[model samples]
Target: MPGPVMPDQAIGTSMRNKDRISAFLTLLPSIILIGIFVYGFIGNTFWISLSDWGGAAALAENPVKSYVGFANYLDLFTGFLGGGFRQDLVNAVFYSVMLLAGAIGIGLILAMLLDNKPRGESFFRTVFLYPMSLSFIVTGTIWRWMLAPQGGVNILPTYVGLPPLRFPWLSSTDAILLFNWQNLLPIALYLVSLVLIIWGLWRLKNNPAKALVLLIPGVVVGGSVWLWGDLLPQALFMEEIHGFNTATFGIIMATIWQYSGYTMALYLAGFTGISQDLRDAAMLDGASTAKYYRYIALPMVKPITISAIIILSHISLKMFDLIFAMTGPDNGQTGHPALNMYLTTFRANDFARGAAIAIILFIIAATFIIPYMISSYRQRRSR
Candidate 1:
């Protein structure tokens, strides 16, 4: 049988419990504050998105906010009022893809070059990262001036005895690689097939049998769609051409210039963390510089690349300030959902529709973020 606990020992135990209680109390206020401000607001926004609350009297005290289900979402996706919304959605998708590719690719190249320890490495690194130090508003304003149709970059040609280029940088209404918006099903199928094919090729050497299984279905579905896409039902009776807006080129250029330095910094840190002994061993094994990076260094720093992608992709989704500064509001050619959401809510007084757009953006951003979060969580669990 156990003896009675000593009074001093009991006091010590009680003191530890009190300390734990005190620690929890210290955190409770912050947790409550965050819960209300962050999650509570998010819930309120989602509820507003599902309600009928907009128009002339939306801002009035005690305004009517009746639940309307998904009417706002349906209208944005299919109704006549959705034309600008759809166009902005397309632009946002294209922007995210292009920005991710350009920033990550360029940043990786710069990181690799810097890893070579060239002369004046610190100066060059500073020069590369200098753009990131400037605010997006400043960057956008500067680029807007440079890309103005009659001045800046256009006039540089005249200095070389050439005609001044008259290309419209941000005001052009033209779009290239046009596709019918009504063919969403066929396009989706094609995209799915392309993903499968890429997945198969990526795993070809590791598991040829599984690769063949994925590849065959992808090829069959993709080829069938390519050859007989006309058989598919149209999403809409009317034809709508949506494509890459050339005007966005100026915006994309400015975005890449501003963010690539950040990605470079991430990749540079990753490269620096790599053991020099490993690089020396690769060199001793007759690995060329290209092969050294391709086979060794790159694979080691893939996490940095993935992190950069997630950050940049979400940044692309919420691209409002730069676009607004560059082209102002509602310039269909350079509009994004974020800009459209602002105008719809504040300027156009379509609060419900704006809320829907915000929800859509939230979902899109989640698509990039949630997967990475799950991956990180699984990695942590495995460890």
Candidate 2:
């Protein structure tokens, strides 16, 4: 009942199957190489992190690595010697937050200005983006000279017939907004209450039911904390003041200068992608420039904002070269996990502990990346 298959048709089908096999074979080597190199190394690193491999033995060619379950991690977090790591972690958090705020805010402003098609727009755009092309080493070296106590920025005030700034730019040890680490529990409770109250207020008009649900817990927690604040358990016997370090300001300034322009470019591209017709429509509707951008443009380019945050935050976490080039190693004010990891592994010959630090960093970075990945996946599924 079926028609006879033609030789040409059979030959064509065979050829296609062969082509697919050939194509797969062509890519097999690369896939195997990647699997062996990238994932293999990552797995080895994780194994090392879970082992006891350090000190003099770590530098030996035939180092003995014994399996130890999370001792290194525990030491880093709660050990007496880990004070530096804690301070470095705090610095990293502050750096990431400040860098994100400064870079995004400044970039948005620059993008808005350039969006108006001002005179010499191309030249200005090029100038702003030029800094991003420079390596961190170059940027750090330049900034180091500029931030020197007696040389660059401090002397500028003298040129204007004002007293030179004696304030320590890179060597200052003072911190502001200091809070005792012993009160972490109370502080955390207070922060939670504040967040709930803010969320309730935000939702009051549109979702009164949810607002009340949020507000009730917030009020109860806040009132409880106010009444029984002293009853909360202290995390430490002595008060440990940790706050924003003034010494990191110079590094922060240099980082902001280098990266803001890159964010500006991203925003500019986002702005360009927006249809002119939408702008015309907003204008016809009597929307001012500020309102148009605030209400329409920003909402449309939110993905770009999220991308910028993820990129900049990871960059902040991985900051070692710039910090090293600027301030060198062991400066608690500007020390990041990356630098600490290097010092631990190479300088101290503590391979296992270094591996633990690397894992912590990897986990922290994953915290930022994984959420975005899941959200993106969910969005795609929804579409």
User: Which candidate leads in lDDT?
Assistant: 1
Candidate 1 per-residue C-alpha lDDT over 277-347 given as tens digits, one digit per residue, 9 for 90 to 100: 99999999999999999999999999998999899999998779999899999689888999999999998
How would you encode candidate 2's per-residue C-alpha lDDT over 130-248 as one tens digit per residue? Answer: 88998889999999999998889988989889999887888899997777776878988998999999999989999999999999999999999999999998766666677888999
Off by over 4 Å in 1: 1-23, 209-233
TM-scores, one per candidate: 0.92, 0.87
Cα deviation in Å at residue 179, candidate 1?
A: 0.9
TM-score of candidate 1 to 2 decimals: 0.92
